[model samples]
Target: MSSNLPKNFPGRPASAPTPSEVPAPAPSAALPKNFTPEMARAAAALQAGAATAAGQAPSSGAAAAEQPAAQARGQAAMPGGPEVTRGEIADHFAQRIVRMVDAHRGDSSRPRLYAIEFPFTDFEFDVAYALAGRLGATLSASDAAVDDDEPARPLVMLDRVLNNPQQFERIVRHINHGQDVQLVCTRAWQLPQSVADLVDATLTIPRFDAPRFAAACVDFYELGAPPALGADADWVPNVVPRDFLLNSQVARSDIVSAVRQSVERRLRRYATDDALDLADLAGMDEAHDWARALIDEVALARSGAISWDDVGGRVILLGARGVGKTTLARAIARAAHLRYVEASASDWAPPQNEPQLGWMRMNAAFQEAMAAAPALFFVDDVDAFSIAPWAGMLPAFLEQLKGLSADDRVVLIAGAQSAEHVRFELHRRGALETTLTMPAPNSQALAKMYSVLLRGSGSTLAQADLEHIGLLSLGMTGHEVELIVRRALRRARKDGGRDVSKEDLAQAIIEQRVGPESQDRRRLMAADELRNTAYHEAGHAILELMRTRGARLRYASIIPRENGSLGFVLPGVDESRNSVTRNDIVEMVRVALAGRAAEEVFSGPEGTTSGCSNDLQQATAYLRYLMTRSGFHGLLSLDRSFEDSPELRERAESMLQAEYAHVLGLLQRHRPLLDSVAKLLIERQEVSGDELTRVVDAYRSSHPLV
Candidate 1:
């Protein structure tokens, strides 16, 4: 056991308690009349430390020479000088702690065990007597060097003890047995895992941040507010006089601003240019609508117009890649005037070489973000890191989101390419209740978006023209739409000037879908082979233009290109309304076999080239969906495991062959229309959906359907 007396307290001997009229330390700067406990401790510590330094100056050796200058700056000439004075403040602190601790435990004779895990620099082990006094115990109130001993009764000191587990384990064991001692520690993570349940509760004292720093400085210095801090971590005032932080005069607003600046500097944050307005987000109706609500709600809550429980919370936006989900999230945060931070997926699931380091960095980022609450965290592609191979680290991430979601200030918006594919338990109702799938832009929305994108670039294209472009861009993303305008401008620039023609934009959409001709090998096909490719592609165009069945064909080109294709066709379909059936499958099979059928009609069996390879694969995939996935053909097997059985392959092959025969007959009957389309393709090399539909519509008006 150690003495609880304030003995050896500089100028005072080891003795019983006495109300020493010790002159309080005069602050270097002006302070307010009223003071918190923290302020009082700081003043007394600085005063006693200064007195001790002045008295010992002659014997202080090298420090003796610096005494005059040190006094001018309000500092002790010797090391750990302020700590000597802090022992004096411990007398008052001890009494207050005992009162609070006893109030919690009632009048019971059993001593209640507790720990004060303060930072190594701010640990006040000397004040253990105040806590131990309720149990008629005593502890030594002394400080000058770091201690790691788990002292009996009142005092048990540890200096960065979490870094030394052996000593920590011993202390934890003692406490877990319901011992009477009150121990002090520094970090919660440092606690022994074996005694986790024994801990009654834990309270976190956050690091010096903007709001608290401002309040502390304002009251401590008797000033209106604190000075603005810069992004530099070392920008704070020197407040080491017994852990009483501020002694300077600055304003509250400046302090908050400085803290905001520091948060951006110390944490992973997005730049200002990344902020988008909610009105600017295009084609993500579900996400966009929800964002408007979030912005409004966040505003109401920030202004105290709404209850705390009504504030925005967790949101998961499930959609395809490049669909503006991340952008939408940023826009909402910007509108709500909240700081935006991104959780890096790559960092979360790091390389196998140093995975532990990666998690540590990720956790640090999360902690820093939490430290600056009332901010928005944008986590893109969460499913990438929150899954099986790396699931061990996922719970920690989820726990963070759960914690933030419950807070009235923080807002979390997470995005994933495929939500159902995400195996994390966050998808459950309680974890992330507001999960929404982003709806792709329809023709109407696409028209509006195109007009908005082109308006800045000086486009006089009418509403009808915008609608036509939208129809062509049926399944394209917003990013792809921007690319269309850029590609159009570049193409127009090559043709004299940047006054882009409608055809140039149309061609841009074509190249965006099919591989650009520049990417193809320079090896040109023979004349006959070129014509064969044209006929194969034109067959697809005729069905798309004249047949009035299946998906609409948006672009067709016979030019050899990258991706191993001599020609490719872009088809348009509304994925949102797609409900595939057996008939749709049969019609698509005929369309898939159309190219081969056209090739056979033009030059017989030998002319039927390998150009139909893609078509066959497409048709077979659809067949599998029909048989196994959709159960369209009465395959009652509810088991979703992929089927590669010989019987299944045979059935698919038989169905494809039947469809191929029917397609051949249809192309033979409509060979002239196919030839006309093929001739046009061989000449122009590419045809837009609108032009194809226009010419075919004229032909159809003259000749009625059979």
Candidate 2:
């Protein structure tokens, strides 16, 4: 057989094929006149396989033609020895071309079969557009896949479009039929079939987290290059390497600014690492302190003053959603001068990949982070990663994290949306010796923050105005406060880019109560549904004011809104506030049951709807805490066997029922107040605490609570 392959190609036939050993093509050969070097090697492999099956021996002329190449790769991992049989040659060719396709193919739509397993769907673009973005090709998409003029780029929307014959055929033709046609799948979606039928070869991308996310953005912008590159120092974000790919398109400053707006837009959920600028950060003193400690530890490790394990291997940042855990972790990394590499739960368990491979992938990711030592290793949404009874992964990941933390040069931080079940797993084995809870800023801090954030938008607010806004937003996370700023900016842009008016600030607060964005597009509630919602929220408002001193009631809304709420009475909790007494717990249960009790009293049981499910759930959860968290339940000794669970349930149910009864009686006595508040809610669609109080006061003057 003749050959043309890379000189370093592994597994050359392990012998010098002497002049007497070469074999020739058969006399009836149908070889083409022109073929690629790769095709020539393939044809040679096939010829050798066929000849070996037929028991043919090599001739002198063929041996002479291929001897040097054979002897060159003689020691490669081929099974057989120096005689160099036809089967051996075919195997060698297979090892070279088939086994190692990925390393050589970078962004080339090569002739191949492969799959890509994404960890999560950050952005699920259309197949045509996604393919165009990846391949640097243009494609015009139509409603029907078959109707598209271009068939050269055969993309697949395997998630939903696979059932469509045209799309399925396109996937098949892209993989099994042609060379130079690349196949692309849009974001993370469930796989329709088992791994075998669907995937040929899966492409695994490097795990991306906030640090790498920041680094990539920095690298792409060339924001700060080495002094040799002559870029301004301020242009560079404080990010270092694990540099993957940089686009270098010289994006317009406004375009880059627009990309940045996405960061602020997402601040309402979690802090984007890129968006954690020190100037924008406010009210996370505890988390920032943790960041400083981690930075100091990293510096200590570098100076040989402490081992990596001694760097306090893990920090568990506990907070509600939209809190600054992710942002704080990123900020710590940037301040500590470490690269950030984030691996998520989805990264550990991707769809379609085998369970074994998933573990291996996760383990490999940790190893990679260690290689990028002096890096911040973060695990985000850890609770979501393992919400089941036993995640089957906790032990291994826990150990891996602990091991990495001890490395003396790497830092590990885990962000939990809530630190409930996993807290023990994190703290028990000393896996995470340190725990930091990132609560919301206090009213005073929030007032100060509001002043700063509002002023950043070129708006001014009086001390009284800031304090009022802060009181109204007392329970909000830092990200939520930032979102209010983002909203004010949006308003400022609308109002000819001037300053944020007081009305703009008021509207932003209203948006926080009812929306993450505009809610005008949602369907309006029917008149009856609107009435039920108004009265339900009014019940919560009245109970919150009369019982908790109007401190808990932030704003009551009857409008359908974000997070699947039909109506809601949001309560404010001090950011620095921790520990609720048993009475506080009981009062909270009553407040939660107020909406349902109101429905039963005024509209009857049939009038109640599924809208009260969340309220019922909250009340049930607090009651469960009373039974289980012995410290709160006043139990001197506890037994978690839960053997008396039935009795516990009965007691909890009875207590909840009594609270419901109590709420019912209160609503009955304040029927006039309830009617007055509900009427105002229906008129205005929202009622702040002061308005609710004023209405209640007016009603009491007309009909006293006594």
Candidate 3:
């Protein structure tokens, strides 16, 4: 027995009744504000039960409540005189509750407000159910109604504060109304300061010992033998459910097999044989290394070499959607032999106009994760939850995370779009410390991914061919790569179920990464329309060659595209330069409008076609970016629609006009070179790479930038 009691508690009187002498209160008798005769009797009953379990006499302390001799210890005797066991946990916790009640009996003004932190809900339930029965208390949620005249009993608040802190305010109201209540909770971190002050103290139920747990199971289930556990076992009494032990087909002699069957049934959805191992994942080497360290720590914990608290697996996964964040998280869980539980940001979202529901759902998730320890708790789109510090329910979310992080058996993995968008405090120590970004896999990594997906599919490709296909699908995500492979497989099926060839894969890539092939549409165009398309593309190509030093013209096509382009100029961007300067943006805007400029320069303003509509829109976008994001208009850049501000809109339009005129004049000055490129494009449907580069180089050699 221990006491962290306040100084004002009075000493126990010598005349107080012993364990067997306390009397039950009358139905009409007014109950004391804090201490009730029923509670004292209940405490005595628990003490007597504990003493009997230990084969000793009950101490001369609180008096027992009236009950059958067999039921006093939560047991029941059959008609033939055989006694049913009530389990060790009930007896063990009974003694602890007796000491707690005795240590605090002198306090007469406040309720018996105590918090009990347990590892999982089953343990919490076992302790709570037994404690409530012994104390004659009602087991209720925070919202359950309380009768004022009932005997004082511990009001067990299971995961209430963490699930919804506002529920505590209701509790405060109950206490303020002078109700005889005792508060017991699983968490105190989310309790409001007012309620926290009223709480007497908190205690933790230690992890159950294997022998005690097995003994309880054997006695409860009447099994032929006890289930075996490792030397460093962390098993709980309810890991194998009562119903399972009673009804399962596994032989009673093989208790271990029954336990395994029950666990697998419970976790059938999470741990599957087909789930990829951490080693099988590709294109995420950094995440692979991170998971390797975590897996090793999990192994160490299982081996009893280290505690789960020492495992550093709490991390936030940052990446674009469809970049395999969820897949990678699942793979890690599989690798670590953890139960997988997933909740997205939307899962925690409150109903529209019902803000209180937010924390309610958030707490529910944390509660579920806690109940499933040695599990992976993954929350996708965490940015929506922790977008900013002042966001509603973010504090409660953090509090729940803090409580979860303190638990050694569960690993927290949060998925988000970007690390910067999430609150920095969320990434601080004791929270989700590691931030792993799953960027789009590069060409080489994509090549490996392709090879993996194509294996056993009867699709064979040379290494060079795979790399070439990977290069062609450069900007696609891993999901996109998989989609293309599936499409390729389908394509092969249409062609008599033949093995997927390089041409099939390439076509699939072109369909997804590029727009639909438009060769038939291009063939339908008039020669005059083809010539006009050539001139428009030539306009963009020549200006790009002249205006930007880093921009390389990959190709220019006079063929119509499925995306409504009559012809287009594709430029290869500089991979090394991550950001563009203001000057670079200016040149980009000019190149975007050059197609329209070339039309007027060659065929006069009246002859310019609506084919320039796309060009005008592209140029307008660039000009808006300069005004709103690049601070071209002012020192304070506002990332908003230019239409929101009249002045900003007018400024953008003026910049677009100025750039258009500038490119028009430049095109006019280089009329002869533009004519040469247009003529070449008119002869061949496309001009690209070294061929296009040489034509521009020859012109630049003779006519250099001033």
Q: Pick the candidate with the highest lDDT.
A: 3
lDDT of 1 by residue, 1-706 (tens): 0144233233333332333312122222233323332343333444455567688422322222122211322343123211123322333344444445566677765544455443322334444322332333323222223244453333333333333445445445445444444445434444445433444544343345445555544443334446555565332322222444212242434444443444445433444355656786667767767778888888887777875357655777888886777777777777887767777555566556544445555555665444445567777777775565456656656655554433425677778887766655776654566778887777877787777777667777888878878888888887788898899888877877767767777778777887567554456778888888888887777765444445566787777766667887777775455686677777776677888888898989987887688888888777777787687767685443225477777777788888888778777876767788888888888787667777666666876422
lDDT of 3 at 13: 29
Write the residue-wise lDDT of candidate 2 on 1-706 in tens digits.
2244333322234331211211222111133322322333334455464567579862322332223322333433233211222222222322232223446466676565444432222221222233332333322222243543434433423243343456555555555545333333321122335322655555543334444444434433333521131233221222112122122232423323433343333222222345455444567776666666667877888787877666764777778877677767776666666667777755565334233445555655665455455567787766754554227557657766644435325677877766665546767666766778877677776777777666545566688878778787776777788888788778888888787765576568778766743366266668888888888888888777765422545677766656666767777654544566777778778888989888777788788988889899889887777767747767654554334677777778888889899889989877877887888888888667667777767776877654
| lDDT score, candidate 3 | 0.65
What RMSD, rounded to one decimal, does every model reach? 12.0, 16.9, 12.3
Tell me the deviation in Å of residue 392 in model 3. 3.6
lDDT of each: 0.58, 0.56, 0.65
Model 3: how far is 44 from its true place, Å? 30
Clashes of each: 12, 10, 2
Question: How does residue 466 of candidate 1 score in lDDT?
Answer: 81
Which candidate, 1 or 3, would have the higher lDDT against the true structure?
3
Tens digit per residue, CA lDDT, model 3, 516-573: 6676763567766777788888988887777655656656677666777667776755
Q: How much lDDT does candidate 1 score?
A: 0.58
Best by TM-score: 1
* TM-score of decoy 1: 0.67
